[model samples]
Target: MSRPNLRVNAPLLGARRSGPARLLAAAGLAAAAGLALPGPVAQADTASVRCSVPDLVEAIGRANGTPGADTIRLAPKCTYTLVTADPGSPANGLPAITGDLTIDGNGATITRPASAPAFRILFVAETGDLTLNRTTVSGGRATDCPLFPGEGVCGGGIYNLGRLTVNRSRVVHNSAVTTVDNLFAEGGGIDSDGTAATVNDSEISHNTAAYSGSTPSSAEGGGLANDGPLTLNRSRLTDNTVSVADNTDSFAFGAGHAAFALTTIEHSTISGNRVRAVGGTALAALATGSPLPGQATSLSMTDSTVSGNTTSAPNGVAVGGGLGTNFPVTLTRTRVVDNTATAPGGTARGGGIHIGRTGDLTLKDSTVRHNTAHAPGGTARGGGMSSATGGTVRTDRSHIRKNTAEAPDGGTAQGGGVFNAVGSTTLTRSSITDNRAVEGGGIFKESGTVTLNDTTVRGNRGNNCAPPGSVPGCTG
Candidate 1:
């Protein structure tokens, strides 16, 4: 398919000399300093070339074969659209940057085909030190074209399999669709596998990973998926989704997973993303060779907020709405609140947060509140926090309050504030208050040793007919 002809805008030079007398004064100063000189001191080798989207891509493709260094500059207000499918040839639509190349967008907009092949807009594989500055990549999605089904697999916005640095750029409204055996398709905006990428002062939002029709099911990353060393400084990830059916026969172990990383989220806002599985948000590995095991997903946050996310399914399957961690999940100076998980009865159990077995969770100077779990005449426990077998959770100088569990009568509703099953828990200098459930309104402990020190568990009410349980510091 032929794309519309793109108009390449010319580079805008700085303002020219207005008055002739001023230009003469600048020339006289040069004569006094050295030999003859022309106008104002010509700015040092800061020459900038301007090109539209197609011209920029063409220049990069030409430089890919050259043996020297090349840098392509994009003009401001310029837009490039990807309309054709993969031409079934190497170096076809594949722009290359061999040396240190800087594709300065100059505030340009690069768009992709809206229909399919949402995987990548600019595939930068085998590039050496690529830098994208002040550019915007949008409307890209991952898809397997009938002509080249398995070829276009990876990154929806920009696939960087090399050292990449993106500064002051925006990657939004992209998606990563499903492929063949790859059950985990991530990075709705950008996907980097085994690459070193740093995104600074950027926004990656409103992207999605559509894996609803994949065999064996899969997890979709609404914002980003990184299987490499990725550092996001001063960035925001919000409003993404992964849709999957919530049934034993149809619920094939994939959907609504972390759009960012199976590793870590540091100093960023991972809020307002929706995942359709039991635990919709982030899922980290537990131990190597076990199921999903890796220490790379260790999210260290300071002054960040993870709130206002929602997860929904038909049957009651326990969905960890915010994050699903299989390792030591730690939060410092963070706030996790106002997230919801809705499951009928066999869909979900934990509403806000779900910790897996053999994982350690630590929260300091944080708050987890106002989360809800709707069971509808079934057993649902741990509205705010839920831990599984062999899990260790510790919270210090924090608050866990105002969470609700609407489990029906004669149902097992335990731990409205905190729920621990087959795991060790420690609460110190914290507040667990105003949570409601059928039993263990404040705290629920099942086959796990819980140690509480200098904490207050107050105003939490259980079913009126059920007998009151022990409050913090008030042992019956």
Candidate 2:
């Protein structure tokens, strides 16, 4: 769970100026440069920065020079466009945060010009803690990093190695692209390898992560990639993309949200995201964990919505159009709908949700509906929900309906509602209806156990249950 290399050998301003002399020297530099530095707001530790990019950079450098935590108030509604990286960090537009700092944007913006050099907007070191409020960070490109060759670029908008919290903010129009083999282009919007990162009342959209390598590479988390604990509340992550142009063994994963550690999402929305990879694709909207059982993570969602997500893997299997999980998951009062998964020449599974072989899911008071899974030249299964071997899915007071699975090119289509392959599926007080498939319109049992308790499986097309006696209490 290591983050991208954001380190540089540039010296800090505090190295030359410390204590009262540093403050005096900073004020002298500002005065000599004809800079209008605002007086302290409420406290001596607070510095009100003007709307200029140079002012912002100098303020950050001053804050880094201070010993304790500092507060920086920015100009209202002004967009500070940076055209060069800070001398302290070669990969960041602003100086690297070396200590605790809070920036009150006051509805302003911090961005890098599209024609500027390749660098991210912000970088927080391991000992730094950053908090942003009412800010907008956009138009950052982390690509072709000469500082760290072969490591690939990451965190186009912001990179964090300590505690980071963002509130009432937006991160958009950022990109992370890599040109090396066996490298990664990760976190188009934000990347965190810290103790924790939280986002509340914010939006992350229009970000892209693309990997173009002939060897085994990966493009992950078009919106965010967190290697530590992550929590999202009342936020939206939409219209992000992860694309891989390698037919070898490359992967494109988590177009909206990707995390390798504990992830919790509440009252949030993840929609309109896409993933396209020739080697493989997973979790077009939300995904977590790795393939290894020892490193499996956990995800919990409450009162959230995952919709209008898509996945396309023409050369390989497409799994989990809306939610692709490889660890433990629990969804309460969540809705996963209107997702599409298509693999024209390969297998397609889990239009709404896919539970991997090592994943066990619990759904309570949730709905998985109006999803489609299509594979014209391969197999299609689980238009609503699917589970692999050794996985278990339990639903209580939930609804799975209006889902379709289609395989029209002499391929198999099974489980329009729920598919259990060598796994266990148990439904309690749930309904699986209005689903369509060539076979097993309600429930498909492929060498697994399907138990229905106080659940209704009706109004399905083709058939209610495959093999007639596979799922007890469910009949056409």
- The number of the candidate with the highest TM-score is 2
Distance from true position, residue 111, model 1, in Å? Answer: 0.6
Mind giving the per-residue lDDT tens digits that candidate 2 earns over 60-80?
999988767899999999999
Q: Looking at candidate 1, what is the lDDT of residue 19?
A: 18
lDDT, candidate 2, equals 0.81
Every model's TM-score: 0.77, 0.88
Candidate 2 lDDT score at position 289: 50
lDDT of 1 by residue, 80-171 (tens): 77665445322223353444567777898778756543335666553456778998888876553211234323466766655678888988
Q: Which window of ten consecutive residues has the lowest lDDT sum in model 1? A: 9-18
- C-alpha lDDT score of every prediction, in listed order: 0.57, 0.81
